[model samples]
Target: MTTKKYADFIYKQTKGVCNIMVEQMFSDYVLYKDGKRIGALYDNKLLLVSTENLNKLFPNAVQEKSFDWGYYKLIHIENTEDKELLEKAVRITYDDLYFQKDFVTDISYLFKVNKRYQDSITKIYNLHITFLRFCYDKGLLKINPLDKQDRILHMNFLNNDLTENGTKIFNELYDKWLVYTDKNDDKTDDRIVNTKMLEKYYLSIIDKLQINS
Candidate 1:
């Protein structure tokens, strides 16, 4: 959707042609063949992961951008696009864990040219994931030559000492995000989950919260 070329390692590695980036369903991305989604995008490039993975790598990845929810988990990926800063950013983004809806309490980073937002709960989380998806889509966080070790940083932070108030604040903010998302999106039982986009925001908020916490 963006004109700017993202920092994608897959594009660099395969010269812009990778069919099944993930092991499971190729739904995260619509692979372009002559500009059409023949399948999904999952390579060493980026893929979906679990909530536990989110927390383990979030601190090191998106240290500059984080949020709250206390779930502390994320997916793992081996960035090999040659952009350390961007890979660091993506590592910080919980790119594959947004489908659960058990965590994630904010979405206000979509239009975040500035740190603080006016909408607080609803806008923060929504915008945050939106921005991550945009970055991923536009290859803003793609890195090259991702080391084998770089893909596995699943160290849990739950045992670490997070402030009681910080935890409370995280929950409060996250709750606001939930309400906002429900209000804006359909509240039907059959609602669909956009995990790709969720991954972006999940990591973004986790990164933000770590700093503010």
Candidate 2:
């Protein structure tokens, strides 16, 4: 299990130097740069991945073998407090492992993935509104467009259709929409027909109608 303190340490050490995000891989926290796996935190220690460029960058860097795998050699970072040294090691490893083509491809792939995810959420919301409209027509719902309270219930029903993060965002949007609607309910002149004219027309339409005698 990766500890927050250990993960935070690496994130802090590399702050403003390089783009990095600490992620857990197989119970070990690994650092990624431009979608490349560059380093890892194992047993509460930071280790830069062993690669040709890493070996070249730090010729005297100590290589330790993990007990999990006999042949796997990892460069353990002993001086955890040496920010400058740590940054240099990480920077060199990142540079060496960096590939322009792979970087561009990964970025494009990420964009496509995000776009598809957003589209799916939009589709879900469209269906959700359609379902709510049906319910409103059947006199089962009070709000046609749905209020936060109703939306929360609808979201729960379709929870499996969304990612955990997506659900949180959707809920937040629901709250915002509720607040906005509450604020603008009386201010906005959004009604199509005047209530007085509508009521009068409905009430007197039969009296004003001519019969074909």
Candidate 3:
């Protein structure tokens, strides 16, 4: 709902930017002015310098309304997306704004929302990967659900841009995998012992997924 293109916004303001991600977080980042902090934005809210410092610099700065979105507290940060103004935010807030809640993402929700595109994943894969690879990469299949031929045919599902639902499903599965792996890890463990074992059974998982030339 935010017309804001966060990556483009930041890039326009700071040309030497790093990788851009939406719905993720970065720990306390600083703005350098001869190596000094002036202001900060956190969880996307702009906080100003100390009460006194903020008054001195941005005398007219005031609270703005959070944006309207169903089931989410998405706020529109005005004039503050750019660096010049944002620098002052860090010095003022003492840190970026941290929310008690995290961004919401559910893959099932996406599937339901885009029900019209029933096999959107298949379509995206078809448009991109060769049918063979598309069948191989661009899908969300169960780990136990795949046969060698199934894997070979579905690898192209990976090439699909992924409906919001697919992404959520992938993330949920991945998060569970990470937790399971980490919990299984004791000392100096890669944490995916269980998965690695599964890999032995599916070693040729990517064999069917020939990359497009």
Estimate the TM-score for candidate 1: 0.17
Which has the greatest TM-score?
Answer: 2
Which of candidates 2 and 3 is the stronger one according to lDDT? 2
Local accuracy of candidate 2 as per-residue lDDT tens digits, 3-74: 888889888988756567788878778788866777778888888877686787667777766624334467
Off by over 4 Å in 2: 67-73, 100-213
What is the alpha-carbon lDDT of model 3 when measured against the actual structure?
0.36
lDDT of each residue in 1-74, candidate 1, tens digit only:
21113224334444423232212233233323333222223332332233344446443432211222144322
Q: Which ten residues in a row have the lowest lDDT in candidate 1?
A: 152-161
Best by lDDT: 2
In angstroms, the error of model 1 at 135 is: 44
Q: Mind giving the per-residue lDDT tens digits that candidate 3 earns over 1-213? A: 222344335435643323212232243232232233323344444333344444545555554333222332222235655586654443333322221122323334434655687555433322222222321244433222234543323232331334333333434444444344333224314333344533332333333333221
lDDT of 1: 0.34
> Which parts of model 3 have CA positions greater than 4 angstroms off?
11-52, 65-82, 95-213
The estimated TM-scores of all candidates read: 0.17, 0.42, 0.22
